[model samples]
Target: MATEKSGTVGKALGLLTLLGDYPEGATAGQIADAVGYPFSTAYRLLNTLVETGFAGYDRREKRYRLGLRIYQLGQKVAHHRGFEGAAVPILQRLTDLTGESSILAVLDDDRFLTVHKVDGPQFRTTTDPGDRGPLHTSALGKVLLACTDPATREHLLETIELTPRTEHSITDRAELRRQIDQVRRRGWAGQQEENDIGMAAVAVPVLSASDRLVAAVALAAPIFRADQEALQAHLPDLRRAAATLALELPLRA
Candidate 1:
């Protein structure tokens, strides 16, 4: 039999899940109606969530939304599921198709952070879990930048140092912006020896059910084995894998 405390906890969690579905946030009355809880009980639970930082209440909007704390917890959950778990098979399949290394990356502040990687028989990439790279020099980063909001993208481009990783790296702000614009139009991004000499890569955005960009899946290879054209040729396969991964992985936002 469920105790009173356990029942309350269950209801609170159900309410939280419902709140997640509405990223724009909802009111206490809406949450109560959705969860079938009493108005008073729902209000108490929302206050608890806000105090704990699990949810935030906007004073001006008078709506409750998932807080930064929830985002932090989600990131930890994603990392736990990434290595040798949900993302492995997809990465392995990409590597198999391209005969190159494949990577899964998420936006980490102003940079792209690799979460998982699978190497093909022909070559292995240096990227690994916790490794971060600039958004202007790598295919995965470019896709992420392209999918971000215009204001946030501009802030990142202006603040983050665009150090030249190689002669091919785009250090000019206008040029990089144009490149990201192209990425948005093409639905994919590619780099030829930009992040590292002799390394070429192509990436596709992994979007959630709500069409929000959550992560990216990329194929990387040695320039000698696969140039930009070769990477572009494998985009169809990469996009398919990315689509599957988007459904499998939890939504970051």
Candidate 2:
């Protein structure tokens, strides 16, 4: 029984790998061809994936895409830290001052997770503490990505396929590398609807006293409230707050 279970796990992993390679998704026949499994076996495995919430079938497209359950699992793993609670008051202050949603994000494996968020009283926003977004499309992700070593950044680029979340998303590796360089030089990052239409964000890196990158803070608002000029105007405040938080973080050494 144990051997049978292991074999089944291997087959499931192969199916998932095949699905991941095709972001638009694939039919059972395509997946079977890629995995070199019999069509009947592939069909059974696909059904199991859909039943277990690891994959979903789109009737319109007749293809299988990754399901929300995977995202929920990733989010669950990313929000395991208790330190996020400590950042709430600071996040609240940023929201109170800027009238935009303040977010605290931590870098996960090639992704960014919002660990804490304070919504502005003026308007309701979609982000929550466990919201997960891609590294290339988010202001918070850019700030954290910039703080990493160049080699690690390259590895991250090589591992994850960048998707165009919006027209402004930096999908090209070269452009993303250039943007990260600018973020490092400027000490902050800004995104104008890079991930969502009519939404904008600005981020600053929080570093430990030993200069290790710890986390990032971001302010998100609608385009009308967070235009390019407004994002630039708030840069100083965001940087100051990040610096203050950095000072409070425990030293790595």
Candidate 3:
């Protein structure tokens, strides 16, 4: 009985998660197929969600989507998380010192998700908060990969699709492993036009008080303005900011 109840709860949560991913909304049949639940079951669950204001259904489109309640809850969680409070000032300081855009990112499953950014007055990057990037190319991604446990890193490297975003992107798994090893040895990571043609970036890990990797702090600039050497030169300041951020983060064990 307990197992049956747990499975039902899991399925309901899975449906909600799937709905959250489809911002444009999806039909009951589509949701049922996606979650591998019976059509009737999916419809019932979606109706229940709608009744609770956790989801909305469009009669004209015959589609279901996450509702205002989810957005409100997400905003509340984001405020309580204090990620912006802890990171914005550091990013601003780093950007001021380096004369480049500074970004804070966290590993989100197989991708790196930028959470905060501060652009230098002279230039700005295309990356923005909520943007997701591949793990093998970006400096922030490399720093995150380097800081993960060996087993987790190996699993991610093997499982993640190594799509080349640009000519400099490392599509070769062995080469990516080598680069991650270098990042581990150097305590930071860098990329020169790897993810984009005219951009360069360097990143250092932000570790918790217990020395657990929590996130990465990165600085990006136009390749003409800052080469790898120039980016590396800013490491001391970046590391200092990262240290301060680590202290500020409320990481859980």
Predicted candidate 3 versus true structure: per-residue lDDT over 136-164, tens digit per residue:
99999999999976777889978889999
TM-score of each: 0.70, 0.66, 0.69
Off by over 4 Å in 1: 1-83
lDDT of 1 by residue, 1-253 (tens): 5698898888778878888898888999999898888999999999998887688887778999886556556656766675376888888887877688899998766788787888868777878666778989999999999887677678887787889999989989889888988999989999998999999899999988777888999988888898988889998999899999988987764
TM value for model 2: 0.66
Model 3 segments beyond 4 Å from truth? Answer: 1-84
- Model 3 TM-score relative to the real fold: 0.69
**lDDT comparing candidate 3 with the true structure:** 0.84
lDDT of 2 by residue, 1-253 (tens): 9999999889987898778787888998999898899999999988899888688787667898675557456556655653345677787888888888888777655788676788888776667766778988888999889987577677886777789987888889889889888999989888888888898888988887666787899888888876755877888788777887676644321
RMSD to truth, every model: 7.1, 11.7, 11.1
* Residue 215, candidate 3: C-alpha displacement in angstroms: 0.0
Error of 2 at 65 (Å): 32
Two-way lDDT contest, 1 vs 2, winner: 1
Candidate number of the best lDDT? 1
Give the alpha-carbon lDDT of every model: 0.85, 0.79, 0.84
Instruction: List the candidate numbers ranked by lDDT, top first.
Output: 1, 3, 2
Error of 2 at 229 (Å): 2.7
